[model samples]
Target: MKKSKWSAYLAVIMASAISCFWAFWGSMENFHEGWHYPTLKENLTVMAIQYLSFMLIFILFSVIAILLPKIGSILYFLIGVAFSYWIFSTRSAITLSVVLSWLPLTLPLLLIALLFWFGEFKNRKLALFIAIGFPLLICCTISIKMGVRVSRRFHDGNYEERIVKGNNDVTLVWASQGPGWPKESIDWAEAQRRCIYLKENGKELADTPQNIWRLPNIKEVTSSLTRNGQNCQGVWNPEAREANYSFPPDKESPLWDIYSPIIYFWTSEEKDKDNAYIVVYHGGVFSKPKKMRGSVGFRAVKSVKNR
Candidate 1:
């Protein structure tokens, strides 16, 4: 009704228009690799979900606040949890609702909810951006956050490479792409390539020069394997696969019982010809000997920063 309310609504309209175009353009660009893939079904699915979530919470709250404003806030809060849970059900969509990511997302919704009751006029534009942009951006921003070299899609479908940095320098590091040999012994060439990759791409202020080396000695390798947190344990799906953040066909989805989450990262340094240092953390901490690579997974690391 008020001028500000109209402005807010206008912003939502614009953001929706822009985001729709953005998603469309993106889908078209990938039409080749996904030539036979579903056309707009998935796109419509995500967009519909996003829009309904925003409208049900913010727009409905505005309508209900005509009488009971506080009750509307409670409803608004529930919308977020519902939205987040829907995301978590699919591992590919988990990033949207995970605790580390959910904080930033929920804050704006909370503010929008409060504003519905507190602001003199409606500003649907802010709500629109929050609704449309938040989900879309969540898929982009984290990949190149801060100053870390956070991507490594080595050997095509072979693996997904990454390095995330922190203020204190090295945080958590591992690789999840290598020969997963269960019946056979681990491959040595793959081990050497992993180390070489790091040496070629390491730095200090910008990348971890020294921190990126392969565990040259067994003592160093074992020490590295047995560390603080345990994300390096468990069996790994050995097929050469790339990291995917979007929906895909049934055959393409990695949700199969056989598909292994990149849980273990092996050091190139070999203790003996048949054995090398491998971080077998699928759950919490890296443990003892894990000779077989079939039931395990591998990824090489390269530190160009303290990341």
Candidate 2:
């Protein structure tokens, strides 16, 4: 068709190729680090399948934007930016959810999209400003709204089972309302290991949920369980109002009790196959799984506010 259109399509192809190459390099290295050795050819084949599948969506989307000019390139840009940013930031597997994280990446690209779609720099300054400003406004506003929602929910007794803390190491409160650790029997061994890890890493576990601790060889996690009804079919703990009650929907929640209050999460401590413990809230639970591949979900603990 148009020479300009051809140029844009080439650019899209080049960008996609570059990104694919980068992902390939990174994934290969990460696999080596994780496996403690290089990947076999079979593993490489599978990883190739996974990687190509993951990169294809963005590449195809970019192709479409190149092929069509009238259909709202802003949307296309959103797809590109959000997808690339999430891959760069979180480096999640090439799954649909990670693909969706590409929404944020749309901002800067919007300017390019406008340039390509309109072929005019007449209002470029204003358009570029809007492009940059839009995503920031959306992200910041969404974050603030979520914070407010969480605060309101907590005040409404939703998180009663969780402990909250300030960034300044406020004397920790066990999930005050629920049956949390006895405080006297706070498995000191696991706590020592975790402190050692943190000290060595020199990294602080901020307000993110991962900061929540599951003490090794500890049983405090059992105390965090609470059922909303007499049936004990795994309802939110009434005392859990203080906890960041991210419990899945009832239909999605599995039926079990004295459950670790969480399931199937990566623990800071792994003891071979059958036994290990994971964090629940800033190092709170410390439940010892009776079996490997247990499904005790997880949540993080972080400062109430980063400030």
Candidate 3:
């Protein structure tokens, strides 16, 4: 009711909200990467633990802060200092932008610590409820919304092959699950080499280098982008190095494994000797270093043999 009490409640709310946002973000990322599809091979329990670690840690901090303000103040202060040090040390050059970015993450912790130390709250029970319940409610609401969306995703379980007819009559058969369609992230060169070595069946690799299958060019990949089993009508502009699509493609069946973390596919189009073009699930095109890996993969394609 008093001004000081209102400030204390606000501090608790702010801290809880920030922690909850990050926890929810992390959880959503994990869900998309690990739990969206039933065929995902990752252990559900392990993924839950790994993704929800942030939420658990923050919840613990919230409990301690609500019950013991003095100790909580010290804990938050130390965390703020450590975070500040980390921000400064990791950057090679300190600029206004860097300082501005640092403030949002570090300043709140420091302020909350000060507020908790000085402010008085007679209703600790209500404070505890606000601190814990608010975040839990937020996380649950958004997660349910996302879960519904993910459940509605379409997967015909036909990863073996798909006939994608592109502009200029560029028709090709996308490879099935094997060397032609790798599940893990791979560098551009390795992807190219793998494609070159892929067998005609598109599911096996040969000992000697072969050209049965190869990486799809940027134009072919862009035009083949699809959404809900429908082509997205994607067009690539090499001069501008950009792509336009009638509808945004999603991580779904046929072209992509919804559960896989690989979002970008390496294209045979090269920007230069050092960099090559890659296409995203949404049909966006960008150039990345040939040697770079992580979240990047390749799906070998070949000319339709019978056609």
Candidate 4:
């Protein structure tokens, strides 16, 4: 093969690899979150659309470049410029780190555009194959991996309230659906208020604020982390700001809805008046602004009755 053909192949590989990475990431995210939808058909449909949307643009560009090089070159350049503008507009300061962070995405795009414009490849078939085949292979590999992981996950199909006993003589009845385990992200204050207003059964809210349920403390969350229906023996150290576990916990049943996108749960521990601590599924704790609510939720718990 000539040098120009090799360069064209490299450009095709780069574009396909970049698109495949985004496709894989989007697929995993959709798999994690899309299962919560009502029906199986809905879940599959939504997941396919969500992940495929990420790759469609790149696939179109590749096809157009193979058919009409000049048009594809213009499209790729426009996309690169759009990405650069978005990145710079979103950041308050145009630091080297910012530029460097975006270079991986924008630079390849610009370079690939130039390559498509000037490079000559007699074997258009090979160029098309590299463009489409590589992404297909990546998507298939990721699908198989995600399928295995999902199949192995522990799910009892039970979402009822349960009493969990943990280290430090901590025992609490975790709330079921509703305020205890909400699907939507919530601010710290709203989480607290919802927990306070949660009724005894944990399925509904009361007219007046009730004390039946409240946000679990960081230690309580850590200590109660479980895997395969067994305690993980998690311990939280406030001084060190760390959590240790005999067996690392996961986003599993009883405590967490594995299909839900909410991975971090708000705890009662406040870093300061402005920030509050949240616990992750794997027994990691971090502080966030009290008002930040993207992927963080709350699970209400009440002290177990003396027995």
| Tens digit of per-residue lDDT, candidate 3, span 173-250 | 999887778888899999989888887788888998878788899889888877877778888887788888887877
Residue-level lDDT tens digits of model 1 in 181-225: 111234445545434444333321222333354532222222233
lDDT, each prediction = 0.37, 0.36, 0.79, 0.81
Model 1 lDDT, residue 135, Cα? 38
In candidate 4, residue 161 scores what lDDT?
88
| TM-score: model 4 vs. ground truth | 0.85
Sorted on lDDT, best first, the list reads 4, 3, 1, 2
lDDT for position 198 in model 3: 81
Give a tens-digit lDDT track for model 4, residues 1-307: 3337566667677778877877777677765554555466877687778766777678778878877877887888898999889989999999999899888878988998888777677888988887788777777787778767665566677778878788778898988877667878999999988888888889998989888788889889999888887889998898999999998887777788876778889999898999999998768899999999777888889988721
User: Which regions of candidate 1 fall more than 4 Å away from where they truly are?
Assistant: 1-72, 79-113, 141-152, 156-260, 266-307
What is the model-wide C-alpha lDDT for candidate 1? 0.37
Between which residue pairs do clashes occur in model 4? none
Q: Write model 2 residue lDDT over 1-307, tens digit each, in one string.
A: 3335443443343435434544454354323221111234644465446433444444444445545544436655665567566566766456766556654454435554554565422333443333333333433454355334322221122333334322223322232212222212223243433333331112343223333433322222222322331111222232342223223111011111121223222333545454455533222334364343323433222223321
> What TM-score does structure 2 among the candidates reach?
0.27
Best-performing candidate as measured by lDDT: 4
| Residue 301 local lDDT, model 2 | 22
